[model samples]
Target: MAAIPKTHRRVVLVRRPPGEPAETDFRVEEVPVPEPRHGEVLVKVLYLSLDPYQRGRMRDAASYAPAVGLNEVMTGGTVGEVVASHNPRFKAGDIVEDRLGWQEYAIGGGPNLRIVDATVAPISTANGVLGMPGMTAYFGLLDVGQPKPGETIIVSAASGAVGQVVGQIGKIMGCRVVGIAGGAKKCGFVTGELGFDACLDYKAETDLDAALRTACPHGIDVYFDNVGGEISDAVLRNINTFGRVALCGSISQYNAATPPMGPRLMGTFVGKRVTARGFIVTDFAERYAPARRQMGEWIRSGRLKYREDVVEGIDKAPRAFIGMLRGENFGKMLVKLA
Candidate 1:
């Protein structure tokens, strides 16, 4: 085993931003690494997942999860290698995945920590496709959306971590998939590479409602929402009767100082009998094993694909996260910490 360092760096939330978070909101500091206690293991972080939901954590507000306290480590999921262990479930050289925050090294033994099988895929994937984002895409679309064969599914932020998987899975389920992305590049990737029936560049399209109407002429049956706000309004406006919407994140409004007014299309839901349900990936925790196995098979057989946009270090997390919120990232945002 390699010698453990006495100190390592980690990013912590130093200020709560009322609007978009700036780099000044975080402070990267080098602190002494602590030894693992009984039933705990020390891990060396390799990759840290930068997600949209973390923006909500930066705010000191009530939500489904607790906010990141000021001057505390910013919350995030990490894939790491166990360097030392006092836990029977893990040992040296074992790769593991956990919500260990942004740090070079951390103690792991929490209920959420689990060993990552390196052979099935790369360790970083444990933080991306095979991790929270993939699971979120699987359950949120399958269980919540309940897409049926021949249905038309439109996914907003279609080139993102969860959205990309959602659209591909829709295709697998025999649905006509249409993606709404930010730029021509992302739109091209969604259709040319990911095999979506069509993709609309929200930035290029002058009339999104009309574009959606044309792409999904049969009308959208399932809408997997990732970036909410105006885009969602357009999709909702074109939804078919009995349509299903799986509400995920709202990246467009995450950095807002004040919550925007509710969408004007909710009344349409009453007339159309649409079903919209919000979900957190952990809602399907007990079924992850089988879900992951199925996803793994899809990946191995070249049915499902994933892309990641990686920044080199922990110090870059804040800036990269901000860019991701602004729709600058091409795919899954990750910090390569090791």
Candidate 2:
């Protein structure tokens, strides 16, 4: 009913970062709002999900996904409202989720975009708990980590988006869940609020290995790794024989100028019969429907709890993203564009 704006605001990658991404690496500019053609829809982004993985996309180097080219809109996941549509399936005001990047408007759709029910949960959750992060925890832990009841499961970045879900799921599956987080505040939330058996503050402790040993006396049967640097090295040292590790992220190394050097894990893997596998959420795309149903039930029943740190405005996305990289966000980091 309202007239659509001719131009919209967006953040573009102006320069590739040599290391940790600076706000200057990105530039906010006003661009023409694209029109949708046949089989397409025009979306007005409401929430932009800021994640650690976006850092990898800033590099020109090859990765699982293509890099964000210089002067191009920065790549990101977003929850948006359909403002216009040429596609029969979508209509104006319909909420949807897609990789629409750091922009106010997008003009595309297909398998990459899906309509989401705002009534089921907060539409913003399509970017966090009920979306990629939730699915990542579900499959990464259940399919990859496979914790048996009474076993010990330790998750790095335990109070984070994927980490929080992984720890909660481990507990639900009857495992002794121990979380490794950065500070006392996050550590407290992980244990007291999220119901993890124990949470170690890696930032406060001088000897992470000792704290891990004390917390996981039975040895870690499953390690859901998010922060993959020295923390991963410490976790590997405490794994039980035939332990399983689900590698969801490597946030600590995402901004590194060079490959991070750490203790050789091959020997430990061989001696402990550890099974570690890296995975992306898309690998289990076909099963997202069932996973979402289950996660929704968990949320409704209060068995699973989640937190989101939302920054207002699209202009703040760069700063919020950088903060997430520094472990400054207690949970999922998101930018509210609307």
Candidate 3:
């Protein structure tokens, strides 16, 4: 057998984000893969997810979860094939989802892993559509957005993993789905591929209010906001009475050099009687099976579509990660390790 690399091929937190992350923020190193102890399994990672939420992790500031430790591997969800196991519950060929952070291999303890089926969808979907981001879109939009018949549902970052699913699901639920994305390509994908009723290119919209007013002529019933700041402000201005807003993420503020601003129309809630709630996906982990069943069925029926911008090598993980934050990725950003 070939000898394993002595160092881990992983990305470390070289420095915390000043605004957004830069190349220097991550350092690559090789470290020995640890051996599995009792009740533990050693996995060789195959796919690593790069999500916008990771932007928040780069900051030392506290949020729903702790920041990635300084000088440590950046944290993320991953799919890996078990290579060695001291755990009786898992075999060497079993694939599992792990919070393995960023590394080529990981040794994790019991009760922290879930066996995965590579045939269910794709192994990557465990980190994309059926993963944490997928669950976030599901609970946040349906549970909080509460879209209704004949109502308008708007989502920003509309062509991303979560946003794309959100828009398509909104359409299936009988709402007029409108999407806001950064460019024409993404704008096209949201409306054309994902089946949103309308898409507004944030880059091309000269008068966002005018554009929003035109698309949401019936008034907004639900707004699933992933990109906060100005786009959020525009959506807030059009809220119908009893509308709902699901505060999913704020990609706009993730890499800011300074503090960012939220929708200036904070008072709209009072006028419209709109309800806005913030959530972390883990809150609904118990419901993941139900949500995945629905999502999978939709995919099989062609009602839901998914995409991934997969980078082939582990070394390029950092660059692909930064690009996702910049809206360079058209779908879920994934690092293929195998």
* TM-score of every prediction relative to native: 0.99, 0.98, 0.96
Model 2, 108-222: lDDT tens per residue?
6787799998777899889999999999999999999988999999999998989999999998999999999998999999999999999999889899889989998898899
Error of 2 at 3 (Å): 2.7
Candidate 1 TM-score to native: 0.99
Candidate 3, 279-307: lDDT as tens digits: 88888878888898898888778888888
| Global Cα RMSD, each model | 0.8, 1.0, 1.6
Task: Flag regions of model 3 displaced more than 4 Å.
Answer: 1-7
Q: Which numbered prediction scores highest in lDDT against the true structure?
A: 1
Q: In candidate 2, how many Å is residue 196 off? A: 0.4
Question: Residue 77 CA error for candidate 1 (Å)?
Answer: 0.2
Model 2 regions lying over 4 Å from their true place: none
The digit string of per-residue lDDT tens for model 1 on 135-249 reads 9999999999999999999999999999999999999999999999988899999999999999999999999989999999999999999988899989999999999999998
What is candidate 1's CA lDDT for residue 113? 91
